[model samples]
Target chain A: MADPAANGNTDSGGSRIGRVPAGYWLAGAFLLVVPSFASNFVMYQIFGWSFILGMISLSLMFLAGYGGMFSLAQMTVAGLAGYVVAICGTSAITDISQNWPWYINIPAALLIAAIFATIVGWLAVRTEGIYTIMITLAVASAFFYFTRQNYVLFNGFSGFNGIFPPQLFGVDWRNPIAFYYLALFWAVFWYLAVLYVSRSPMGLALQGIRDNPRRMAALGFDVTLHRVAAYTFAAFPAAIGGILLTWQSAQISPGTAGIGPVIDILVIAVIGGLRHPIGPFVGAFVYVILKSFSIDILVALGMAGERFQLLIGLGFLAIVFWSPDGLLGLWAKLRDLNRRDPLIGRLVRRL
Target chain B: MKTRTLLAVLAATFLTATAHAQTLKVGALATLEGTYTALGEDGMRGLRLALSQANNMAGGREIEIIVAGTDASPDSAVRAARKVVEQDGVELLIGPLSGSEGIALRDYSKTQPHVTFINGISGAQETTFVDPSENFFRFNMDGAQWSAGLGEYIYNVKGYETIATIAEDYSFTYTQVLGLALGYCAAGGEITERIWVPLGTKDFASIIAALPDDVDALYLGLGGGDAVNFLNQYQQAGGDAQLVGGTIMVDGTVLSSKGDAKNALIGVPSSGPQADTWDDPNWQAFVKAYQDEFPPDQRFPSPSLMATGYYNATTAAVSCLNEVGGDLSDGQAAFRSCLSNLVLDAPNGEIKLDGNRQAIGTNFISEVVELEDGTLATQLVKIVPNVNQTLGIDPETFAGFGVPGRDVPECKSSY
Candidate 1:
């Protein structure tokens, strides 16, 4: 049987980077210097949003890819962190916000989100396959409704606006350049961490459990403990992304973590490719670019701007139809073709 | 061949750049997606009509409007606003149809001092009341201002001494309820119960059962689908309580809703920014212009309140451009000054800004009545002129009532 879950995954963390790939070096350099030429909108709205979204989706990838848990509550965990920040930190809703310092609220938000995720994991882990998705979706839906209805804390339908980033190092952290670097740093940190963890013994054990839970249990591995731990680990990146997202928008509402966004994070993870660490970021960049420019594209094509959703849906279907593993899988197939058919590959390369 | 192609490309780029410099760029934002799509379409129609009246020329420059759409989420609104301001480089932004979107944009306006923001149908009280932005101007009345004269009309004319309220629980509806409760209680009226329902509620069985039977009327502060749903279920349950409609409950959006339940809305007294059948010449002209501008199939018989709000905002922007000769240089200081003091003779009424740049305009108390063609429309009963954000109460006294919420502005009479 083809191991679809483990497809394209290679190496353990102990196998260190033997001769770092040229693509990685080039990508790193390009990202570091992007702000020099990019406009404030590109840096702040496009790249900054992508990095935050990528980090959240990366948390999902870490679960579905390494631990075989496809939890939809990742976005809810992120949203919970954002809500904690708005409630604890300063916001325009003077009556509701406590106006605590960022130092107190930031850590508090992370801890609360992590704890919430742990509880959700404990409940969701008992279910397998499709049931897990249904359970996570239910949790996410409950959070959305609760936040919408509870005015004393969550501020009901309107929620909270004007929740700006605190000034750090004499810089408005929400400034386009500053926010881009902030989001980029967190995204990269989580990316490397997930990559390293996936190769570790813990990651292998989780993968074994994913393949056969009974076999892993028979082999003396604590399958449930590892699955729950994966959720806790995933929450950190999602929480950090949530904090950055709230800071970027300067507001948090029930719609921020509503059913729409919860599904969007999953769509982002799956489209980028679940087999590797870089897949989610690739998917996120595509998604953000499409969202930002779809109006112009539709208008240029002589179509109504409201049809952008149709375009996105079509693109999503095309990608999924041709490459079941996602864009990364498509790229891998192209590379394999180049190696297998030397004459045709050389002629195409020459052109 | 390559040299000729390159030269042609350079020439095309130069021609486009020069053409762009001769035109003025403005951004128009609306919730073109999600639940408020119909409202947003009307807002855009209002904007286009105003632009067409100006012949798309303001000051000495040709006006160029860049349109952006949002899903009514604050995040999407901000991103759309940022793209137009930072990427497309618009001098002024007119937009954002939802309440929360307005509050978020008001904060965003603080970050962009050079770009002026004109409110478009966002009736959130806090948008201008709290930490108001200097460059942001709202030409439409807030939710509280829309509730003017409704309480007195209900108590004195309708002989409703005791009433209960059923409102969608949100900031905007809270402001409306606060306005009604304060006005009614001050006029020797009493409120027996207040039931706050979440938006998008489908069932009204329990709510109808829980309503106090002794109350003379039930003040409905719900809007959109919630209003339609409640009315349908309430009718099925054989509800006979006299209805006092909120500004939105009797709006064309709900009146035009498909169902026989809307018949329950007939003779229901309500108050809002404008009445559909007002005989005022300006309003008649506006209605004619709106009908002439778009096909009958595409628009309602009367322009929606959202359409009126955007029309007023666009008129202010366009006239200011004329006053300043379209010169928006030096951080738009001259334009801002002209806008702040300029009185707008809106189709509904004469609108002027208060100290916070929020509109102190007119309100109309009306009752829903079916027209000759069997279409429902609000007929004018009373006109409340120059109603301010504070609902005519003294500033200190109004502040004492605190921000609008579940129990805010206390329903009981102080006397």
Candidate 2:
């Protein structure tokens, strides 16, 4: 299949010239206006979660798609940020939080998360392929246990609750519209950042490393450093997402970094199409919608509520089988098929 | 013309009165699809049974239940609660079957000030005792309150002088261990060894090996599949330390799955109500109602502790609603006051919330016994009446007692 990026026909120069595409502007406008039409539930559950989870999975996507590194530690990085936020902010479980101002807490959480990710990435980048996955998984598992058992730090398994989003500008940041816009700003910022990086010279170098790491290393591209950089870059957004997630849920616990959720982010990235910047958000939307409604749907169909996971697994499996690149890849394939047959292509485009 | 005008006014008033009988929306949140699924299902069943008995009417208004799955995480529970409140527009919320979820929901209750939240089997002490919410009420006891008399039961009745404690390393387990240790130590017993296992520790070989041979009993505070794994592994290892602790150790699922291993629990006193063995008419009726709703099948033969907890909470909520005549237009404050003053005739006995909105009710130390049918059952042997959130300790001292842990309560010979 052709590269989705190539089909866009935009170059680094286009981005450098600050020539924003019409579609991009239209999408931005749509997102900005979503708060007006969307209900508070939609804003919180659908958009809020999609943006946060998308940012987390996008980190994974950037690493996997560009650097050829599949780190299971993206959610772990997010969890680290959440823990930092809780520990630095007021919470129900502990008095350990310094109760610092939001300005201090948010940045400190992100910095610590990024540092943690960098250290993990530095250790993990030494390995390749499945070994990279295994090492990251091990790190994730270790973090989960560490947080769960270390009562003085992570407050044991109950974790920290009442970690509210900072009330800023004399407004509660968690209020539906405010929270939505806050999430939107970060999500869009990261999405564009990922897009720009993917087209930059460094991004091209990382992609080269992804395609042929030995060759890139032999050619003096410093492959390990690039991979580590990818991880560090990815951690920033993930950490922000983690902070947002902590604010969204008003709590942080071992479950946030559990093995199940760590894998779910990978699935979301893959299901959305890891090759593209927009894939994670697309996948997150699908996942969040299904997760929110699958139980009710199954119960309505006279099935047990627990079968919701089964349905989700089946859906993921079907998508993977149908198109290795996920839903976006499938869409790309259909579009390619249409282009082959102009008559059908016109009809398809019209539809 | 005067007669026609009078008739029109009467018609308008009658229409307005009929419209006032709106359906009352209530949300039921539980970990309906994860590790604690059995507990969540049992809770839902108990809730539905209570609602059925109430004819689905509360305060002269038809009740509409909106169920959301919590997935047993604090994050998911908060999200589920939000969906139920913001999306489904439920006036009241019940649920979130785990400790962390309870704390999260309590925090969330502050955000939704007008929404009344009744606890659904979440035993985390912090949900009420540590940081109580005015809009939140728990009719069921916290983990510590549930294990009120177990220590005494083990020391005085079971003759366990020095016992070892093995519990899941979490706030809930910590609270459970504290409860057991308090009663045991107060009765002149000792906890010689304390083993805190991480939540998902499947292999108990090392943990079993760590158990001191000198202890009279090994109190087990693990729950669900973890409990099942620990018990099976302990038995397989030929470890014969008498097991006793909290409700989770001898839950219905654990009993049936343990098979011949179930014998080890016989005469071992633990916490929680045992449906099959409780002789109280109210409990029997509740069991009958549950069985009628969910007949004896491959799933459940009798109601579990989760069921009883939800049933009691729902019963309390409905009773309060009945008293208020379904008028919450005055908002959660009116309902909060009503709940504060209300004393519920729960199946276990009278359940009344103390100053902190935590239940002060009967806490049973039930003995594991083989029923006539050869099924394992927990039979209530002792009742600690009016077991409060403070566990009989003064609030200030109890607050300073620190969070339950491997080392807390400073074991003494007497209370």
Candidate 3:
């Protein structure tokens, strides 16, 4: 009989192995500590944003990479969480709201996001791959304009702003570093937890279904249940990321859930080498860094930075043509080279 | 053969590189290369003139005014914002050319706290209302603030009993209608109905299908491309609606983008610091200088609103910088304090940033008239200065004014 633990993930030696490769945890730990030595601006701004976005992309990885499903609504899901935070609780303030304490509003917002995600998942999962994408895309588009016109709900175009984070542990997490650590803390916890879940029997069943849903169903696996669970699991990360985004920017609007941004999540996952737990982080890192410098390169070429997409388009095309596996895959090849170079190792020892 | 061809191309390109690639980086993220690219280019020209006038030196900085024309997409706006913040090394930012862009660009603002962000007419009201870090400020009147003069003019002054809200469906457009309705409602008037169409909607038949004939006045929140369609269709469909627009409804630049729709629109636009306010000889001379530097089509009439926004927006940022001069560490407190306590002279008149850090400035109510040039024009008739008066509320206060929020809808549009 097969083991049910770690979602019943076992090696030939009969020892349980985690869903995430061990390297992923090491990388997460490495990233967590880098902020300590980094500049406040780097730690607070660039690194913090990367972590926030990484977490969001992590949810996408959970859905698309592991579960073999692609839903555009994860970004929308996060945005919904952001809107709830801005409009519901203590963060709701005098602008989006006049009353509400932090404790009451945040959980309410999170719960609302999860419930909405559950409903969306149930409806979206009713259809297969491409249909799920289309349905979620439709939902996202609906949310985008709905927030714009429904004055009573979204306050029309003005959108809710000034969504303040709680002074958790009596520390003002609004500080860039504080926010950074908060993001890092959440990211690490999820990394560990998801790693655990992916190796579990449920994870294996989900993977089995991904390979051949009909066979998995005949084998007595609840295909529908597994898909729903994947989406629900994905929603937890997306919701946290969205809530963090709201707190980070202190605002929420239709712009957060717009189509362009929704699609970019796919781009991030594709670019990060969508093979493992570390892929989302790698993708987000490159995306942030690419954006950080794209405008300057454009300006140097006498092109307006505002129109930098013309240049970025070329870079994206190059990446797709040259390395289909993305930056992480390229890094792996380079690491392989380093391993094979005896002279390099001898030189390293001499140094 | 392919590699040889590549080498030849690389060599050819390398030889043509500029000797001194000294780029003057003027940072802008206007909607210039997409649906609203024309408007974005117009904003770029506005800043170009300002840069040329200053010889590209302001607060002792020389920039090439590097542009990051957005496709009027929020994600594109962020890409543009990143360009300014990281690549162009822009001391400040000027636009995203739309309300949604403004909202997202402001989120990017936190990522580059040292770089000041100014709204380029992304008048969603929420941009600088409450979530505004000291880094982000809008010079131009917000969507709600622009319509500050409308309610009184349409209802109290013109004595219209009921009005219908017809606008493009989006936050900025929707909020403008709401602001007008709020103003009208506060003064004991009712909005007959609210009809919203998509931003690029070419036909208004569906939305126009619902207008009750009882409305004596029509409140227009339609803008740019959608405005032209709305007006063109409203007239063709024989909707007997008298127009009272939110600022850009009758703007010359907006008309330029629509090509022929200039002839169909006639009304009082209530966005402030308009060109007619330059009726004073001193300001007229500035106009004459502006005219001499650029062709007629290049001249922006609504500099009354836009330029004032840029000036006030920059001033707000600088005030914070001045207080925290040479001290980047505690810049946050000084910025918040500077913003909270500022009362500056904006070209639109005196602008005071309320407790919410939103500016209260004079708004103009201008009539659309035929100029001698035979072009449709907005002639200044009245100015409603400081529409907010004493109401110092932020976006946080503003959004929660009525009801609760629902689940933000998921994206439904396919790329």
**C-alpha lDDT of residue A259 in model 1:** 91
Off by over 4 Å in 2: A4-19, A341-351, B1-21, B332-334
Top-TM-score candidate index: 1
lDDT by residue (tens digit), candidate 3, A146-192: 88676676765546665678787899997767888898888777766
Error in Å for residue A191 of model 2: 0.7
Q: Write the per-residue lDDT of candidate 2 for residues B1-415, one digit (tens) a residue.
A: 1212332343233121111239988899987766677778878888888999999999899997878887777888888898878877788898868886887788889888889999999988878877678889888888888888888777787898998888877667777877777778889998887888877678889888778898787788887777777777878998877778577778876776645766777777788744357788987877778878765763456777887788888888898888888879777566778899889888777889888888888877787788888888788777778888888987787888787766876787654
Residue A75 Cα positional deviation in candidate 1, in Å, after optimal superposition: 0.8
Model-by-model DockQ, in order: 0.34, 0.28, 0.07
Find the candidate with the highest DockQ and give its number.
Answer: 1
Docking quality tier of candidate 1? acceptable
Candidate 3: docking tier = incorrect
Candidate 3 lDDT score relative to the true structure: 0.64
In every candidate, what fraction of the native interface contacts is reproduced?
0.44, 0.45, 0.10
TM-scores of the models, in the order given: 0.92, 0.92, 0.73
**Models sorted by TM-score, best on top:** 1, 2, 3
